[model samples]
Structure formats: C-alpha cells, structure tokens
Target: MTFANVGTLGTKPGKRDEVVAILTRRNPQLESAGCLLYEVGTNDDEPDTVFVAELWTSAEAHQASLSLDTVREAIAEAMPLLSGQMGGDRFTVAGSPLRG
Candidate 1:
C-alpha cells in the first residue's frame, strides 16, 4: 500500500521562510528515494506553522530515506527554528472501489 505522512512544524517567528527554504533544498533526496508526492506549505490560519504532505511508494522506502545522514542533518538544523515539538502521522492509502 502507498504511504503518506502529514507533519506539522511550529516555527519561530520570522523563521518560516528560512525553514521552508532548507526543507526545499533537502527535498530532492527524498524525491529520489521514491517520494511520489512532496509538498510543503504554511498553514493558512497560522503563519508560523508549516505543514508537509508526502506520499511514498511504501513505508519501507520512507523509513530508508529517514535513515540517510543528510535527512538527519536537515532535521537537526530545522529543530532550532521550531517553537514547539514537531509531530506527524503516517497513513496507508486505501483505494476506493468506485474509482477502480
């Protein structure tokens, strides 16, 4: 089944753009690792928050990408800009019978 992750980042004031830039720079590695869809954007109601939506071919592929040194480094760098704990959830896609 396809895997999807939705993450919320609570960035410090004035650091949203910088955080997004850093994330954007690191996105290529994820895309190369079977990320079918990757999107990052700020919350409309909360400008200081950033949201990431990612879809991967499988959970294993997503886990492998997380194990990369570059990914770890990027996450470490982003930690300081955060105002609160970063959290996310993973989901498995279920196809609709009507769409098949």
Candidate 2:
C-alpha cells in the first residue's frame, strides 16, 4: 500500500521561506529510500506556515527516511526556524488513477 503523509509546519514569524527551502532541497536518497512523491507548498494567507505532501512505498519506508543522514541534517537545520507547531494526516492509499 502507498503511504501518504500531508502536513503543515509553522515557522517562526518570518521563517516560512527558509523552512520551505530546506524541505525542497534535492535529495536523491529519498527516491532510493522509497519516496514516490514529495511536495512542499505554502499558502499566501498563512505566511508562517509551510505545507508538505509525501507518498512512500510503505509506512515503514516513510519512517526510515527520517534516519537518512541528509534528511536528519535537513531536520536539524530547519528545527530552529520552526515554531514547534505542526499538523498532518497519514493514511494508506487505497488506489489512485494516476498510478494506473
């Protein structure tokens, strides 16, 4: 089953852009780690928040990706820029027309 994760990260007042930058940086390891889709976005009305959507081969793959050195480093870099506020949804995708 495809594991999907969609979330929002609230950044310190004006740090949304920085967080987005960190999240969007190219990480080929993600593909090797089983990431199928990874997107970072923002809402104009939410100036301090960054949104992310990700699809992985499985829930375990998603969790394991966090242990990648580059991923860990990115998290370390973005942590201080965040406000510690986060929200998200995770689910096992039943099917997708795009996949077929």
Candidate 3:
C-alpha cells in the first residue's frame, strides 16, 4: 500500500527557512528507497512551522529511510534549529484521483 506521511516541524524562531532547506535538499537516495513524492512547505502565519508531505511505496520503506546515512545526517543538522515541537500524521493511502 502507498504510505503517506504528512507532518509539521516546529523550528526555533526565525529558523523555519533553514529547516525547510534541509528537508528539501536533493537526495536521490530517497527515490531509490521508494520515495514517490517529498515536499516541504511553510505557512506565513506560522513562521516557526515547516510542513512536509511524503509518499512512499510502503510503510516499511519509509521506516527504513530513517536509517539512511544521508537522512540521519540531515536530521542531525536540522535538530538544533528545531524547537523540539513536532506534529504529523501517517497512514496508508486509501485512494487518490491523481493516481492511476
């Protein structure tokens, strides 16, 4: 089943851009690992928040991605810029009009 992860990360004040950059950086490894889509967004009304939407081939693929060295490094780099607050949702996709 297609796996989806949609979440928000609370960054330190004035650090949302930095966190977004980290999340959006090019990483071909993600595609190789079964990532279908990975997007990062931000809300002007919530300057400290960074939003992420990810689609993966399977839940296991997403979980395995966490152990990737590049992913781990990016997380480490972004950690200091975060406020330690985070929220999000994960689920198996039921259906999507955009999919065939």
- TM per candidate comes to 0.82, 0.97, 0.97
Model 3 clashing residue pairs (backbone): none
The residue-by-residue lDDT of candidate 2 on 1-100, one tens digit each, is 9999999999999899999999999999999999999999999999999999999999999999999999999999999999999999999999988767
Q: Tell me the TM-score of model 2.
A: 0.97
* CA lDDT, candidate 2, residue 41: 97
lDDT for model 1 comes to 0.86
RMSD of 3: 0.6
Question: What do the candidate models score in CA lDDT, each in turn?
Answer: 0.86, 0.96, 0.95
The alpha-carbon deviation from the true structure for residue 77 of candidate 3, after best TM-score superposition, in angstroms, is: 0.1
Overall local distance difference test of candidate 3: 0.95
Off by over 4 Å in 2: none
Q: By lDDT, who's the top model here? A: 2
Residue 76 of model 3 has an lDDT of 98
Instruction: Please give the TM-score that candidate 3 achieves against the real structure.
Output: 0.97
Estimate, for each residue in 1-98, the C-alpha lDDT of model 1 and write its tens digit. 88999998889998988889878884577778888887899866888888899889999999999888778898899989989957899999887475
